[model samples]
Target: MSIRPTIETRKAVPTMEGAGVHLHRAFGFQDPSELDPFLLFDDFRNEVPEHYMRGFPWHPHRGIETITYVLNGTVEHGDSLGNTGTLGAGDVQWMTAGSGILHQEMPKGNAKGQMHGFQLWGNLPSAQKMTAPRYQDVQAKDIPEVIDDDGTVVRVIVGEFWGKTGPVDGIAADPQYLDISIPPGVKKTFRIDTYRRAFAYVFAGQGAFVDASAPSGVLLEKEVMGQEVNIRDMSGDRTLVRFGTGDEVTVQAGEEGVRFLLISGAPIEEPVAWHGPIVMNTQAELQQAMRDLRNGTFIKPAH
Candidate 1:
Protein backbone atom coordinates (compact mmCIF):
# COMPACT_ATOMS: atom_id res chain seq x y z
CA MET A 1 0.00 0.00 0.00
CA SER A 2 1.23 3.45 -0.84
CA ILE A 3 1.48 5.66 2.23
CA ARG A 4 0.62 9.31 1.80
CA PRO A 5 3.52 11.62 2.52
CA THR A 6 3.18 14.91 4.35
CA ILE A 7 3.60 17.73 1.87
CA GLU A 8 3.22 20.59 4.33
CA THR A 9 2.89 21.08 8.08
CA ARG A 10 1.97 24.35 9.71
CA LYS A 11 0.46 25.70 12.91
CA ALA A 12 -2.88 27.46 13.03
CA VAL A 13 -2.66 31.24 13.26
CA PRO A 14 -4.68 33.30 15.73
CA THR A 15 -7.36 35.47 14.13
CA MET A 16 -10.42 37.41 15.12
CA GLU A 17 -13.79 36.98 13.50
CA GLY A 18 -17.53 36.89 14.18
CA ALA A 19 -17.89 40.25 15.88
CA GLY A 20 -14.53 40.13 17.60
CA VAL A 21 -14.37 36.47 18.59
CA HIS A 22 -10.80 35.22 18.93
CA LEU A 23 -10.11 32.06 17.02
CA HIS A 24 -7.46 30.24 15.04
CA ARG A 25 -7.58 30.03 11.28
CA ALA A 26 -6.15 26.77 9.98
CA PHE A 27 -6.53 27.72 6.32
CA GLY A 28 -8.58 30.21 4.41
CA PHE A 29 -8.81 33.42 2.22
CA GLN A 30 -5.92 32.27 0.05
CA ASP A 31 -5.49 30.12 -3.00
CA PRO A 32 -8.81 28.27 -3.20
CA SER A 33 -7.41 25.81 -5.68
CA GLU A 34 -4.90 24.47 -3.18
CA LEU A 35 -7.54 22.59 -1.18
CA ASP A 36 -10.14 22.69 -3.96
CA PRO A 37 -13.86 22.22 -3.23
CA PHE A 38 -12.89 23.26 0.30
CA LEU A 39 -12.32 26.94 0.98
CA LEU A 40 -11.71 27.60 4.70
CA PHE A 41 -11.30 25.99 8.14
CA ASP A 42 -11.56 27.84 11.44
CA ASP A 43 -11.11 26.53 14.97
CA PHE A 44 -13.02 28.63 17.49
CA ARG A 45 -11.77 27.41 20.83
CA ASN A 46 -11.53 29.74 23.75
CA GLU A 47 -11.87 29.68 27.54
CA VAL A 48 -12.64 33.32 28.01
CA PRO A 49 -16.27 34.36 27.74
CA GLU A 50 -15.45 37.85 26.57
CA HIS A 51 -13.32 36.45 23.80
CA TYR A 52 -16.11 34.39 22.18
CA MET A 53 -19.41 35.48 23.65
CA ARG A 54 -19.72 38.29 21.14
CA GLY A 55 -19.88 35.54 18.51
CA PHE A 56 -20.69 35.73 14.82
CA PRO A 57 -23.24 38.40 14.25
CA TRP A 58 -25.54 38.50 11.25
CA HIS A 59 -23.69 37.68 8.05
CA PRO A 60 -24.29 36.55 4.52
CA HIS A 61 -23.06 33.45 2.75
CA ARG A 62 -23.52 32.24 -0.78
CA GLY A 63 -22.18 29.58 -3.11
CA ILE A 64 -20.73 27.50 -0.24
CA GLU A 65 -21.59 25.07 2.52
CA THR A 66 -20.53 25.53 6.15
CA ILE A 67 -20.01 22.55 8.45
CA THR A 68 -19.75 23.26 12.15
CA TYR A 69 -18.80 20.60 14.73
CA VAL A 70 -18.91 21.53 18.37
CA LEU A 71 -16.73 19.73 20.87
CA ASN A 72 -17.91 21.61 23.94
CA GLY A 73 -20.25 24.47 24.91
CA THR A 74 -23.28 25.60 22.94
CA VAL A 75 -23.75 27.60 19.78
CA GLU A 76 -27.03 29.41 19.32
CA HIS A 77 -27.74 30.20 15.73
CA GLY A 78 -30.44 31.90 13.66
CA ASP A 79 -30.84 32.53 9.98
CA SER A 80 -32.86 34.81 7.73
CA LEU A 81 -34.91 31.86 6.58
CA GLY A 82 -36.58 31.63 9.98
CA ASN A 83 -34.37 28.77 11.17
CA THR A 84 -33.22 28.87 14.78
CA GLY A 85 -31.45 26.24 16.85
CA THR A 86 -28.96 25.50 19.56
CA LEU A 87 -25.98 23.23 19.01
CA GLY A 88 -24.60 21.68 22.16
CA ALA A 89 -21.42 19.71 22.73
CA GLY A 90 -20.82 17.09 20.06
CA ASP A 91 -23.55 18.45 17.82
CA VAL A 92 -22.97 19.37 14.20
CA GLN A 93 -24.65 21.85 11.88
CA TRP A 94 -24.08 21.77 8.15
CA MET A 95 -25.51 24.76 6.34
CA THR A 96 -25.64 25.22 2.61
CA ALA A 97 -25.66 28.85 1.54
CA GLY A 98 -26.84 28.15 -1.90
CA SER A 99 -28.08 31.23 -3.74
CA GLY A 100 -27.81 33.37 -0.61
CA ILE A 101 -28.67 33.61 3.09
CA LEU A 102 -28.01 35.74 6.16
CA HIS A 103 -27.22 34.09 9.49
CA GLN A 104 -25.85 34.64 12.97
CA GLU A 105 -24.15 32.37 15.50
CA MET A 106 -23.74 33.18 19.19
CA PRO A 107 -21.55 31.04 21.41
CA LYS A 108 -22.11 30.22 25.07
CA GLY A 109 -19.46 28.50 27.13
CA ASN A 110 -19.91 25.58 29.47
CA ALA A 111 -19.83 25.91 33.24
CA LYS A 112 -16.05 26.14 33.21
CA GLY A 113 -16.13 28.99 30.71
CA GLN A 114 -14.67 26.85 27.93
CA MET A 115 -15.78 26.81 24.32
CA HIS A 116 -14.43 24.64 21.50
CA GLY A 117 -15.56 23.92 17.99
CA PHE A 118 -14.61 23.97 14.32
CA GLN A 119 -16.16 25.40 11.15
CA LEU A 120 -15.25 24.17 7.70
CA TRP A 121 -16.26 25.89 4.49
CA GLY A 122 -16.65 23.72 1.42
CA ASN A 123 -17.09 25.28 -1.99
CA LEU A 124 -20.02 24.31 -4.15
CA PRO A 125 -19.42 23.29 -7.70
CA SER A 126 -20.50 25.66 -10.43
CA ALA A 127 -23.57 23.55 -11.13
CA GLN A 128 -24.91 23.71 -7.57
CA LYS A 129 -23.83 27.24 -6.70
CA MET A 130 -27.34 28.56 -7.10
CA THR A 131 -29.20 25.67 -5.55
CA ALA A 132 -31.62 26.05 -2.68
CA PRO A 133 -30.22 26.74 0.77
CA ARG A 134 -30.64 23.98 3.32
CA TYR A 135 -29.55 22.89 6.77
CA GLN A 136 -28.60 19.55 8.29
CA ASP A 137 -28.69 19.70 12.08
CA VAL A 138 -27.14 16.49 13.34
CA GLN A 139 -27.23 15.69 16.98
CA ALA A 140 -24.25 14.19 18.78
CA LYS A 141 -26.15 10.96 19.40
CA ASP A 142 -26.99 10.62 15.72
CA ILE A 143 -23.35 10.63 14.56
CA PRO A 144 -21.97 7.12 14.19
CA GLU A 145 -18.85 6.16 16.12
CA VAL A 146 -16.68 3.10 15.54
CA ILE A 147 -14.26 1.71 18.10
CA ASP A 148 -11.58 -0.58 16.79
CA ASP A 149 -10.01 -3.50 18.60
CA ASP A 150 -6.91 -1.41 19.29
CA GLY A 151 -8.93 1.25 21.13
CA THR A 152 -8.99 3.56 18.14
CA VAL A 153 -12.24 5.50 17.94
CA VAL A 154 -13.43 7.13 14.77
CA ARG A 155 -16.36 9.51 14.49
CA VAL A 156 -17.53 9.56 10.93
CA ILE A 157 -18.81 13.03 10.12
CA VAL A 158 -19.30 12.60 6.38
CA GLY A 159 -19.01 9.88 3.78
CA GLU A 160 -18.47 6.17 4.56
CA PHE A 161 -15.86 4.35 6.62
CA TRP A 162 -15.69 1.00 8.45
CA GLY A 163 -19.00 -0.05 6.92
CA LYS A 164 -20.79 2.98 8.33
CA THR A 165 -22.05 6.06 6.50
CA GLY A 166 -22.37 9.54 7.93
CA PRO A 167 -25.79 11.01 8.60
CA VAL A 168 -25.23 14.19 6.61
CA ASP A 169 -25.55 13.70 2.90
CA GLY A 170 -26.52 15.29 -0.45
CA ILE A 171 -23.31 17.26 -0.40
CA ALA A 172 -21.72 18.64 -3.53
CA ALA A 173 -18.10 17.73 -2.78
CA ASP A 174 -18.74 14.13 -1.64
CA PRO A 175 -16.16 14.49 1.13
CA GLN A 176 -15.07 12.18 3.92
CA TYR A 177 -14.61 13.77 7.31
CA LEU A 178 -13.44 11.64 10.23
CA ASP A 179 -12.71 12.50 13.83
CA ILE A 180 -10.14 10.00 15.06
CA SER A 181 -8.41 9.20 18.35
CA ILE A 182 -5.59 6.72 18.58
CA PRO A 183 -4.25 4.92 21.58
CA PRO A 184 -0.95 6.09 22.96
CA GLY A 185 2.12 4.77 21.17
CA VAL A 186 -0.09 2.75 18.85
CA LYS A 187 0.51 2.98 15.15
CA LYS A 188 -2.46 2.98 12.83
CA THR A 189 -3.05 3.36 9.11
CA PHE A 190 -6.17 4.61 7.35
CA ARG A 191 -7.09 3.93 3.75
CA ILE A 192 -8.39 6.81 1.69
CA ASP A 193 -9.34 7.18 -1.92
CA THR A 194 -6.17 7.93 -3.87
CA TYR A 195 -7.92 10.53 -5.99
CA ARG A 196 -9.12 12.69 -3.10
CA ARG A 197 -7.21 15.60 -1.56
CA ALA A 198 -6.63 14.90 2.13
CA PHE A 199 -5.56 16.78 5.25
CA ALA A 200 -5.41 16.31 9.01
CA TYR A 201 -5.94 18.84 11.82
CA VAL A 202 -4.54 17.92 15.22
CA PHE A 203 -6.37 19.36 18.22
CA ALA A 204 -5.31 17.38 21.26
CA GLY A 205 -2.09 15.79 22.46
CA GLN A 206 0.54 14.94 19.84
CA GLY A 207 1.18 12.46 17.05
CA ALA A 208 3.17 11.87 13.88
CA PHE A 209 1.89 11.05 10.42
CA VAL A 210 4.44 9.36 8.26
CA ASP A 211 5.02 6.58 5.81
CA ALA A 212 6.79 3.33 6.67
CA SER A 213 9.90 3.73 4.55
CA ALA A 214 10.25 7.42 3.67
CA PRO A 215 9.45 8.85 7.12
CA SER A 216 8.01 12.12 5.90
CA GLY A 217 6.96 13.64 9.27
CA VAL A 218 7.03 11.74 12.55
CA LEU A 219 6.76 12.64 16.22
CA LEU A 220 9.80 13.90 18.13
CA GLU A 221 8.74 15.72 21.28
CA LYS A 222 11.76 15.18 23.48
CA GLU A 223 14.18 18.11 23.72
CA VAL A 224 17.76 18.39 24.90
CA MET A 225 19.04 21.77 26.06
CA GLY A 226 16.11 23.58 24.43
CA GLN A 227 16.87 21.80 21.16
CA GLU A 228 14.45 19.27 19.75
CA VAL A 229 16.01 15.87 20.24
CA ASN A 230 13.43 14.29 17.97
CA ILE A 231 12.72 15.91 14.64
CA ARG A 232 10.07 13.32 13.85
CA ASP A 233 7.40 14.91 16.01
CA MET A 234 5.12 16.30 13.35
CA SER A 235 1.88 16.97 15.24
CA GLY A 236 0.56 18.85 18.24
CA ASP A 237 -2.34 21.11 19.11
CA ARG A 238 -3.61 23.23 16.21
CA THR A 239 -1.32 21.57 13.65
CA LEU A 240 -2.39 21.18 10.04
CA VAL A 241 -0.93 18.43 7.86
CA ARG A 242 -1.47 18.35 4.12
CA PHE A 243 -0.73 15.06 2.42
CA GLY A 244 0.67 14.19 -0.97
CA THR A 245 -0.73 11.56 -3.31
CA GLY A 246 -1.19 8.11 -1.83
CA ASP A 247 -3.90 5.57 -1.03
CA GLU A 248 -3.38 5.42 2.70
CA VAL A 249 -2.06 7.37 5.71
CA THR A 250 -0.24 6.13 8.81
CA VAL A 251 -0.15 7.86 12.16
CA GLN A 252 1.58 7.12 15.47
CA ALA A 253 0.16 8.42 18.69
CA GLY A 254 2.28 10.08 21.36
CA GLU A 255 2.21 9.52 25.13
CA GLU A 256 -1.18 11.16 25.67
CA GLY A 257 -2.65 9.65 22.56
CA VAL A 258 -3.76 11.76 19.60
CA ARG A 259 -7.06 13.24 18.57
CA PHE A 260 -7.53 14.83 15.16
CA LEU A 261 -9.84 15.47 12.24
CA LEU A 262 -9.02 13.77 8.93
CA ILE A 263 -10.79 15.15 5.92
CA SER A 264 -10.64 14.49 2.17
CA GLY A 265 -12.65 15.52 -0.82
CA ALA A 266 -12.63 15.44 -4.60
CA PRO A 267 -11.05 18.59 -5.99
CA ILE A 268 -13.39 20.99 -7.72
CA GLU A 269 -10.58 22.12 -10.03
CA GLU A 270 -12.67 25.10 -11.18
CA PRO A 271 -11.80 28.75 -11.42
CA VAL A 272 -12.67 30.42 -8.11
CA ALA A 273 -13.64 34.05 -7.59
CA TRP A 274 -13.84 34.46 -3.86
CA HIS A 275 -14.88 37.66 -2.04
CA GLY A 276 -15.25 37.19 1.68
CA PRO A 277 -18.08 34.70 2.30
CA ILE A 278 -19.31 34.74 -1.25
CA VAL A 279 -17.48 32.46 -3.70
CA MET A 280 -18.47 32.62 -7.32
CA ASN A 281 -16.91 31.98 -10.70
CA THR A 282 -16.02 35.47 -11.95
CA GLN A 283 -15.38 39.00 -10.75
CA ALA A 284 -18.55 40.30 -12.36
CA GLU A 285 -20.62 37.68 -10.57
CA LEU A 286 -18.99 38.65 -7.28
CA GLN A 287 -19.78 42.30 -7.89
CA GLN A 288 -23.32 41.42 -8.81
CA ALA A 289 -23.71 39.47 -5.55
CA MET A 290 -22.47 42.43 -3.52
CA ARG A 291 -24.82 44.72 -5.38
CA ASP A 292 -27.70 42.36 -4.68
CA LEU A 293 -26.83 42.34 -0.98
CA ARG A 294 -26.99 46.12 -0.88
CA ASN A 295 -30.22 46.15 -2.89
CA GLY A 296 -31.83 43.52 -0.61
CA THR A 297 -32.10 41.08 -3.47
CA PHE A 298 -29.17 38.79 -2.68
CA ILE A 299 -31.33 35.93 -1.39
CA LYS A 300 -33.67 34.53 -3.96
CA PRO A 301 -36.51 32.05 -3.71
CA ALA A 302 -35.33 28.47 -3.20
CA HIS A 303 -34.80 26.94 -6.57
Candidate 2:
Protein backbone atom coordinates (compact mmCIF):
# COMPACT_ATOMS: atom_id res chain seq x y z
CA MET A 1 0.00 0.00 0.00
CA SER A 2 1.23 3.47 -0.88
CA ILE A 3 1.88 5.72 2.12
CA ARG A 4 0.53 9.24 1.80
CA PRO A 5 3.21 11.91 1.87
CA THR A 6 2.76 15.20 3.58
CA ILE A 7 2.56 17.74 0.75
CA GLU A 8 1.80 20.80 2.88
CA THR A 9 1.98 21.57 6.60
CA ARG A 10 1.01 24.96 7.95
CA LYS A 11 -0.26 26.55 11.15
CA ALA A 12 -3.79 27.85 11.31
CA VAL A 13 -4.09 31.63 10.94
CA PRO A 14 -5.88 33.70 13.54
CA THR A 15 -9.04 35.29 12.22
CA MET A 16 -12.16 37.08 13.45
CA GLU A 17 -15.59 36.01 12.34
CA GLY A 18 -19.26 36.15 13.35
CA ALA A 19 -19.36 39.57 14.95
CA GLY A 20 -15.75 39.47 16.09
CA VAL A 21 -15.49 35.94 17.45
CA HIS A 22 -11.83 34.95 17.61
CA LEU A 23 -10.86 31.78 15.75
CA HIS A 24 -8.24 30.17 13.58
CA ARG A 25 -8.77 29.33 9.95
CA ALA A 26 -6.84 26.33 8.68
CA PHE A 27 -7.82 26.70 5.04
CA GLY A 28 -10.54 28.42 3.09
CA PHE A 29 -11.62 31.31 0.70
CA GLN A 30 -8.42 30.97 -1.31
CA ASP A 31 -8.36 28.04 -3.72
CA PRO A 32 -10.83 25.15 -3.54
CA SER A 33 -9.18 23.01 -6.23
CA GLU A 34 -6.70 21.14 -4.04
CA LEU A 35 -9.40 20.28 -1.45
CA ASP A 36 -12.23 19.41 -3.79
CA PRO A 37 -15.78 18.99 -2.38
CA PHE A 38 -14.42 20.62 0.81
CA LEU A 39 -14.57 24.36 1.01
CA LEU A 40 -13.30 25.42 4.47
CA PHE A 41 -12.12 24.30 7.93
CA ASP A 42 -12.08 26.51 11.01
CA ASP A 43 -10.81 25.94 14.54
CA PHE A 44 -12.82 28.04 16.98
CA ARG A 45 -11.29 27.69 20.41
CA ASN A 46 -10.95 30.16 23.23
CA GLU A 47 -10.67 30.32 26.99
CA VAL A 48 -11.98 33.83 27.35
CA PRO A 49 -15.67 34.50 27.13
CA GLU A 50 -15.22 37.80 25.26
CA HIS A 51 -13.40 36.03 22.47
CA TYR A 52 -16.37 33.85 21.51
CA MET A 53 -19.39 35.36 23.19
CA ARG A 54 -20.31 37.38 20.12
CA GLY A 55 -21.02 34.20 18.17
CA PHE A 56 -22.26 33.82 14.58
CA PRO A 57 -25.38 35.79 13.79
CA TRP A 58 -27.94 34.92 11.18
CA HIS A 59 -26.36 34.04 7.85
CA PRO A 60 -27.42 32.51 4.57
CA HIS A 61 -25.85 29.46 3.03
CA ARG A 62 -26.57 27.67 -0.24
CA GLY A 63 -25.11 24.78 -2.21
CA ILE A 64 -23.05 23.44 0.69
CA GLU A 65 -23.10 21.46 3.91
CA THR A 66 -21.73 22.63 7.24
CA ILE A 67 -20.55 20.37 10.06
CA THR A 68 -20.11 21.85 13.52
CA TYR A 69 -18.54 19.80 16.31
CA VAL A 70 -18.46 21.10 19.85
CA LEU A 71 -15.77 19.95 22.21
CA ASN A 72 -16.28 21.83 25.48
CA GLY A 73 -19.01 24.43 25.09
CA THR A 74 -22.62 24.77 24.01
CA VAL A 75 -23.92 26.19 20.78
CA GLU A 76 -27.52 27.39 20.60
CA HIS A 77 -28.70 27.45 17.02
CA GLY A 78 -31.85 28.41 15.13
CA ASP A 79 -32.69 28.27 11.45
CA SER A 80 -35.25 29.83 9.14
CA LEU A 81 -37.18 26.56 9.05
CA GLY A 82 -38.02 27.05 12.75
CA ASN A 83 -35.56 24.34 13.79
CA THR A 84 -33.77 25.21 16.99
CA GLY A 85 -31.54 23.31 19.38
CA THR A 86 -28.52 23.37 21.64
CA LEU A 87 -25.29 21.53 20.78
CA GLY A 88 -23.45 20.60 23.94
CA ALA A 89 -19.97 19.26 24.47
CA GLY A 90 -19.08 16.52 22.00
CA ASP A 91 -22.26 17.23 20.06
CA VAL A 92 -22.34 17.66 16.28
CA GLN A 93 -24.60 19.56 13.94
CA TRP A 94 -24.54 18.64 10.27
CA MET A 95 -26.54 21.14 8.25
CA THR A 96 -27.10 20.77 4.54
CA ALA A 97 -27.87 24.09 2.84
CA GLY A 98 -28.99 22.59 -0.38
CA SER A 99 -31.34 25.21 -1.74
CA GLY A 100 -30.91 28.01 0.79
CA ILE A 101 -31.29 28.73 4.52
CA LEU A 102 -30.64 31.39 7.13
CA HIS A 103 -29.27 30.32 10.47
CA GLN A 104 -27.64 31.66 13.63
CA GLU A 105 -25.30 30.03 16.14
CA MET A 106 -24.61 31.44 19.58
CA PRO A 107 -21.88 30.09 21.82
CA LYS A 108 -21.94 29.71 25.60
CA GLY A 109 -18.80 28.58 27.32
CA ASN A 110 -18.44 25.80 29.86
CA ALA A 111 -18.17 26.44 33.58
CA LYS A 112 -14.42 26.93 33.25
CA GLY A 113 -14.94 29.70 30.72
CA GLN A 114 -13.64 27.70 27.80
CA MET A 115 -15.10 27.16 24.35
CA HIS A 116 -13.68 24.78 21.77
CA GLY A 117 -15.21 23.66 18.51
CA PHE A 118 -14.71 23.24 14.77
CA GLN A 119 -16.76 24.12 11.71
CA LEU A 120 -16.16 22.39 8.40
CA TRP A 121 -17.73 23.33 5.09
CA GLY A 122 -18.26 20.60 2.50
CA ASN A 123 -19.14 21.40 -1.06
CA LEU A 124 -22.12 20.02 -3.00
CA PRO A 125 -22.03 18.88 -6.58
CA SER A 126 -23.93 20.77 -9.25
CA ALA A 127 -26.78 18.27 -9.31
CA GLN A 128 -27.29 18.22 -5.52
CA LYS A 129 -26.66 21.91 -4.95
CA MET A 130 -30.32 22.85 -4.89
CA THR A 131 -31.94 19.72 -3.52
CA ALA A 132 -33.40 20.62 -0.09
CA PRO A 133 -32.19 21.90 3.24
CA ARG A 134 -31.77 19.42 6.09
CA TYR A 135 -30.13 18.97 9.48
CA GLN A 136 -28.52 16.11 11.41
CA ASP A 137 -28.11 16.89 15.09
CA VAL A 138 -26.04 14.12 16.62
CA GLN A 139 -25.53 13.90 20.37
CA ALA A 140 -22.20 12.86 21.83
CA LYS A 141 -23.54 9.48 22.92
CA ASP A 142 -24.72 8.59 19.43
CA ILE A 143 -21.19 8.79 18.01
CA PRO A 144 -19.14 5.64 18.40
CA GLU A 145 -15.71 5.55 19.98
CA VAL A 146 -13.16 2.79 19.46
CA ILE A 147 -10.13 2.06 21.60
CA ASP A 148 -7.29 -0.04 20.29
CA ASP A 149 -4.96 -2.31 22.24
CA ASP A 150 -2.35 0.44 22.61
CA GLY A 151 -4.86 2.87 24.05
CA THR A 152 -5.34 4.61 20.75
CA VAL A 153 -8.86 6.02 20.74
CA VAL A 154 -10.94 7.20 17.81
CA ARG A 155 -14.42 8.72 17.64
CA VAL A 156 -16.27 8.23 14.41
CA ILE A 157 -18.24 11.39 13.76
CA VAL A 158 -19.24 10.86 10.14
CA GLY A 159 -19.02 7.98 7.69
CA GLU A 160 -17.84 4.50 8.74
CA PHE A 161 -14.72 3.20 10.45
CA TRP A 162 -13.79 -0.07 12.14
CA GLY A 163 -17.20 -1.65 11.47
CA LYS A 164 -19.00 1.30 13.09
CA THR A 165 -21.01 3.90 11.20
CA GLY A 166 -21.31 7.57 12.12
CA PRO A 167 -24.58 9.22 13.02
CA VAL A 168 -24.53 11.64 10.10
CA ASP A 169 -25.53 10.18 6.74
CA GLY A 170 -27.01 10.92 3.32
CA ILE A 171 -24.19 13.31 2.56
CA ALA A 172 -23.29 13.80 -1.10
CA ALA A 173 -19.53 13.97 -0.55
CA ASP A 174 -19.36 10.66 1.33
CA PRO A 175 -16.83 11.99 3.81
CA GLN A 176 -15.14 10.13 6.64
CA TYR A 177 -14.53 12.29 9.70
CA LEU A 178 -12.92 11.09 12.89
CA ASP A 179 -11.50 12.41 16.16
CA ILE A 180 -8.36 10.45 17.03
CA SER A 181 -6.18 10.44 20.11
CA ILE A 182 -2.92 8.54 20.42
CA PRO A 183 -1.09 7.96 23.65
CA PRO A 184 2.47 9.12 24.14
CA GLY A 185 5.16 7.24 22.23
CA VAL A 186 2.55 5.23 20.40
CA LYS A 187 2.59 4.60 16.68
CA LYS A 188 -0.45 4.07 14.46
CA THR A 189 -1.36 3.83 10.81
CA PHE A 190 -4.70 4.20 9.08
CA ARG A 191 -5.79 3.06 5.65
CA ILE A 192 -7.90 5.41 3.62
CA ASP A 193 -9.68 4.92 0.34
CA THR A 194 -7.31 5.42 -2.57
CA TYR A 195 -9.97 7.39 -4.43
CA ARG A 196 -10.48 9.96 -1.66
CA ARG A 197 -8.60 13.13 -0.70
CA ALA A 198 -7.56 13.22 2.93
CA PHE A 199 -6.18 15.68 5.48
CA ALA A 200 -5.46 15.92 9.21
CA TYR A 201 -5.74 18.86 11.61
CA VAL A 202 -3.74 18.65 14.79
CA PHE A 203 -5.27 20.34 17.84
CA ALA A 204 -3.32 18.92 20.75
CA GLY A 205 0.24 17.85 21.53
CA GLN A 206 2.64 16.85 18.72
CA GLY A 207 3.11 13.95 16.31
CA ALA A 208 4.81 12.97 13.07
CA PHE A 209 3.18 11.60 9.98
CA VAL A 210 5.80 9.29 8.57
CA ASP A 211 5.96 8.84 4.82
CA ALA A 212 7.33 5.40 4.09
CA SER A 213 9.22 6.65 1.07
CA ALA A 214 10.65 9.91 2.46
CA PRO A 215 10.29 12.24 5.41
CA SER A 216 8.51 15.55 4.81
CA GLY A 217 9.86 17.90 7.53
CA VAL A 218 12.39 18.23 10.35
CA LEU A 219 13.27 14.89 11.88
CA LEU A 220 15.18 13.81 14.96
CA GLU A 221 17.23 10.75 14.37
CA LYS A 222 18.91 8.19 16.58
CA GLU A 223 21.62 5.68 15.92
CA VAL A 224 21.06 1.98 16.49
CA MET A 225 24.13 -0.16 15.95
CA GLY A 226 25.72 2.61 13.85
CA GLN A 227 22.64 2.81 11.60
CA GLU A 228 21.24 6.18 10.70
CA VAL A 229 17.50 6.81 10.93
CA ASN A 230 15.00 9.51 9.98
CA ILE A 231 11.84 10.77 11.67
CA ARG A 232 8.81 12.79 10.54
CA ASP A 233 7.99 16.28 11.66
CA MET A 234 6.37 16.60 15.07
CA SER A 235 3.46 18.81 14.18
CA GLY A 236 1.92 20.65 17.13
CA ASP A 237 -1.36 22.35 17.99
CA ARG A 238 -3.47 24.07 15.33
CA THR A 239 -1.38 22.59 12.52
CA LEU A 240 -2.87 21.45 9.23
CA VAL A 241 -1.40 18.58 7.24
CA ARG A 242 -2.48 18.00 3.67
CA PHE A 243 -1.47 14.68 2.20
CA GLY A 244 -0.66 13.66 -1.34
CA THR A 245 -2.10 10.70 -3.22
CA GLY A 246 -1.91 7.51 -1.28
CA ASP A 247 -3.95 4.89 0.60
CA GLU A 248 -2.28 4.83 3.99
CA VAL A 249 -1.09 7.27 6.70
CA THR A 250 1.32 6.50 9.53
CA VAL A 251 1.74 8.63 12.62
CA GLN A 252 3.96 8.49 15.70
CA ALA A 253 3.09 10.43 18.83
CA GLY A 254 5.59 12.52 20.73
CA GLU A 255 6.21 12.68 24.48
CA GLU A 256 2.96 14.54 25.09
CA GLY A 257 0.81 12.42 22.79
CA VAL A 258 -1.47 13.88 20.12
CA ARG A 259 -5.07 14.48 19.16
CA PHE A 260 -6.38 15.41 15.74
CA LEU A 261 -9.22 15.26 13.28
CA LEU A 262 -8.78 13.00 10.28
CA ILE A 263 -11.14 13.79 7.41
CA SER A 264 -11.39 12.49 3.86
CA GLY A 265 -13.90 12.71 1.05
CA ALA A 266 -14.41 12.09 -2.65
CA PRO A 267 -13.60 14.96 -4.98
CA ILE A 268 -16.36 16.57 -6.98
CA GLU A 269 -14.04 17.96 -9.72
CA GLU A 270 -16.77 20.28 -10.97
CA PRO A 271 -16.29 23.95 -11.69
CA VAL A 272 -16.72 26.05 -8.53
CA ALA A 273 -18.01 29.59 -8.68
CA TRP A 274 -18.08 30.79 -5.12
CA HIS A 275 -18.75 34.09 -3.33
CA GLY A 276 -18.91 34.02 0.44
CA PRO A 277 -21.52 31.41 1.49
CA ILE A 278 -23.30 30.95 -1.81
CA VAL A 279 -21.51 28.62 -4.20
CA MET A 280 -22.72 28.18 -7.76
CA ASN A 281 -21.32 27.01 -11.08
CA THR A 282 -21.43 30.24 -13.08
CA GLN A 283 -21.17 33.97 -12.48
CA ALA A 284 -24.68 34.50 -13.79
CA GLU A 285 -26.02 31.94 -11.39
CA LEU A 286 -24.28 33.69 -8.53
CA GLN A 287 -25.83 36.97 -9.60
CA GLN A 288 -29.23 35.34 -9.69
CA ALA A 289 -28.73 33.98 -6.18
CA MET A 290 -27.79 37.43 -4.94
CA ARG A 291 -30.91 38.85 -6.58
CA ASP A 292 -33.03 36.24 -4.90
CA LEU A 293 -31.48 36.99 -1.54
CA ARG A 294 -32.22 40.66 -1.93
CA ASN A 295 -35.77 40.04 -3.19
CA GLY A 296 -36.64 37.63 -0.36
CA THR A 297 -37.04 34.73 -2.79
CA PHE A 298 -33.99 32.68 -1.90
CA ILE A 299 -36.27 30.19 -0.10
CA LYS A 300 -38.53 28.39 -2.52
CA PRO A 301 -42.24 27.79 -2.00
CA ALA A 302 -43.39 24.50 -0.45
CA HIS A 303 -45.10 21.94 -2.68
Say what the RMSD of model 2 is.
2.4
- Candidate 2 lDDT over 59-128, as tens digits, reads 9999999999999989999999999999999999999999899999999999999999999999999999
TM-score against truth, every candidate: 0.94, 0.95
Report how far off residue 22 is in candidate 2 (Å). 0.5
Clashes of 2: 0
lDDT of 1 by residue, 34-131 (tens): 88878999999999999999999999999999999999999999999999999999999999999999999999999999999999999998898888
Model 1 CA RMSD to the hidden true structure, in angstroms: 3.3
Error of 2 at 99 (Å): 0.6
Q: lDDT of each model, Cα atoms only?
A: 0.90, 0.90
Kindly give the stretch of ten consecutive residues in candidate 2 with the minimal lDDT sum.
222-231
